[model samples]
Target: MFDVNARIGHWPYRPVGTVDDLLKNMDALGISCACVSSLDAIHFLNPQDGNDSLARAIAPHRDRLVPLAVVRPEFAGWQDDLTRCLESHGMRGVVLYPNYHLYDLDDPEATELGARCSEAQIPVFVQVGLEDARRQFGRTIVPDVSLESVGAFGREHPSLKLVALGLKFGQPDQLRQPLPKNFYFDTSNYERLGDLEFAVSHFGVDRILFGTCAPLFHPRANADKLRCADLTAEQREAIGQGNARALFGL
Candidate 1:
């Protein structure tokens, strides 16, 4: 299975550390690969240094760990950073942390970055927050990015493949009303027994990807969630790995 959302590096608030541990954990759970980003990139003012760290760390394990570059579009000359990530690091996609970067989705720079990614046909992952709201760091009180704003971004870039992370509150009815066809959701935030089944029945199985939210949250819990979900073998295969493979060409 390929995890669409996972991270490597030290998380200050928690004791989670090392990409080696993440690899071992994924192995134990039968997860063959993970699309990972730098946890350091999440908080850094300029994400390029963090991206460099991630590239160096994953250089030897490129087959198992795919690097997703974090780009804070609010910073000046951010487009060049994105270019370097694709050209130098061989990144498969880019993730945005609007809450951490202190920018709204409606900001002009955000749209420009989206357009650029769309033109390049690169996948875009937008994380509302890295940590749970109730247990967030005292220094940084991050808020969830609005689902409405996500819909707007998706509409603006109709062909771009967008994934919304850390979202726990949208019903299928509400999501389908505005979200475009290219928008997908990862399962890291899904904790309930019937959530996956409900989402599949209402919103299509192709739109869901298995995610563990590893190191911050247990990987086994999500693996078991997929293991026990009421889905056919084909559905299980799709959500567990097929969707991610198709979306990111894994």
Candidate 2:
């Protein structure tokens, strides 16, 4: 399973730790593989620094792990960073954190950036929340990415496979709406497992994948939650390993 969300952070501003520690836990929990990034890079500097950190860590362990390039279009020369990620890091996709990066989806630059990602045949993942920071760290906070805006962006960029992570406070009615065919979501910040089943039943299993914003949250709990759900074996496989495999061409 390629975990679309995981981080390498050990600085004062960072919350998580090394990638090896994550791999150890992944091994113990029976996760074969993941595509990881650095939360520090995402929250701190522009994408190149974060992408460099992730690229270095995953280089030796390419068989078990993959690198997803992090890019901040809000910064200068982001296009070069985007090019390097595809040409150098061998990134299958890139993820964004508009809330953490303090950018708006409605901006012309952000819209073009999404278009650039689509042209590169790279999927884009965005973090809707980061580990419920109020409970995890101190009194830090980040704004929620309105699902409404994301839906509109997906509609605008019809060819891009846009993914939303850490989706919280999702009502069942939201799942029933006709989302873009290219739009998908991951499972994290979940209050109940039944909603995932409802999402799959309404949107089809291909649109959902298993994910855990790990090190901040327990990977075992994340894996177990999907396993224990009231889903068929086919649905379970799709979320567990199949969809990510298909998404990243693993």
Candidate 3:
């Protein structure tokens, strides 16, 4: 199976293991491949450093680990960083952290970056939430990027391929209007009963991708959600791996 959401690097609040450990966990969960980003990139002064670290670490396992560069559009030299990430690092996609990076989705820099990625035909993964708000550290709490904002961003950039990670089962429904056809979501924070079925029925099966917010959350738990969901074999296969394969051209 292909995991659309996974991370490698240090998470200061938790014990996020190395790439080897990530591989072992994926193997244990019967996950064949995963799209990974750098956790360090979220908090780094120069996020490209974290992207570089991820590129080097995943070099030997490129076949199994697809790298997604973390880009802070608000930062200076971000245009060059985006170019290097796509050309030099050979990243399949880019992950955005508007919450941690302190920018709204409608910001001009974000709009420019989105337009560029759309032109490049690369998917842009937006991290909606990294940790549950209730459990966040008191002093360093980071709010989630609102789904309304995400919907707005999708409306503005209709051609951009967008995937929102770390959203709960019912969060997307909170949007009053429909998101763009190119918008997608990962199944990591979905936990309620019938959540997967709800997502499929609400968003269509093609838009749902299997994701394990691994090394931060247990990979097995997320995998079990897919295994236990009341979906047909074809539907399950599509969400588990087929969708990701088609989306990322794996």
Instruction: Choose the strongest candidate by lDDT.
Output: 3
Candidate 2 Cα errors over 4 Å, as ranges: 11-15, 136-140, 169-176
Deviation of model 3 at 212, angstroms: 0.7
TM-score of every model? Answer: 0.96, 0.91, 0.97
Error of 1 at 202 (Å): 1.0
Q: Clashing pairs in model 2?
A: none
- Report the poorest 10 consecutive residues by lDDT, candidate 1: 169-178
Better of 1 and 2 by TM-score: 1
Tens digits of per-residue lDDT for model 3, 1-250: 9999999999878677788988998998899999999999988998999999999999999989999999999999999999999999999899999999999989999999999988999999999988988888789789889999998888788888899998887887865556578888889997798999988988899989899887788788889999999999999999999999999776
* Candidate 1 lDDT tens digits, 139-226: 7678888777887888889989999876674533455474589989888886665988988987799989999888788889889989
Across 1-250, the per-residue lDDT of candidate 2 in tens digits comes to 5576676655454456478888898888778877777666766666588788778877888888767777787898988888898898887788888887888877887898889988987888877776565654455566677777788778889899888888874632454377788888887665564877777877788988777777677787778878778999988888888998888766
Relative to the unseen true structure, what is the C-alpha lDDT of residue 200 in candidate 3, on a scale of 0 to 100? 90
> Cα RMSD (Å) per model?
1.4, 2.1, 1.0
Steric clashes per prediction? 0, 0, 0
Compared with the true structure, all predictions reach lDDT values of 0.86, 0.77, 0.90
As a TM-score, model 2 comes out at 0.91
User: Which run of 10 residues does model 2 get worst, by summed lDDT?
Assistant: 168-177
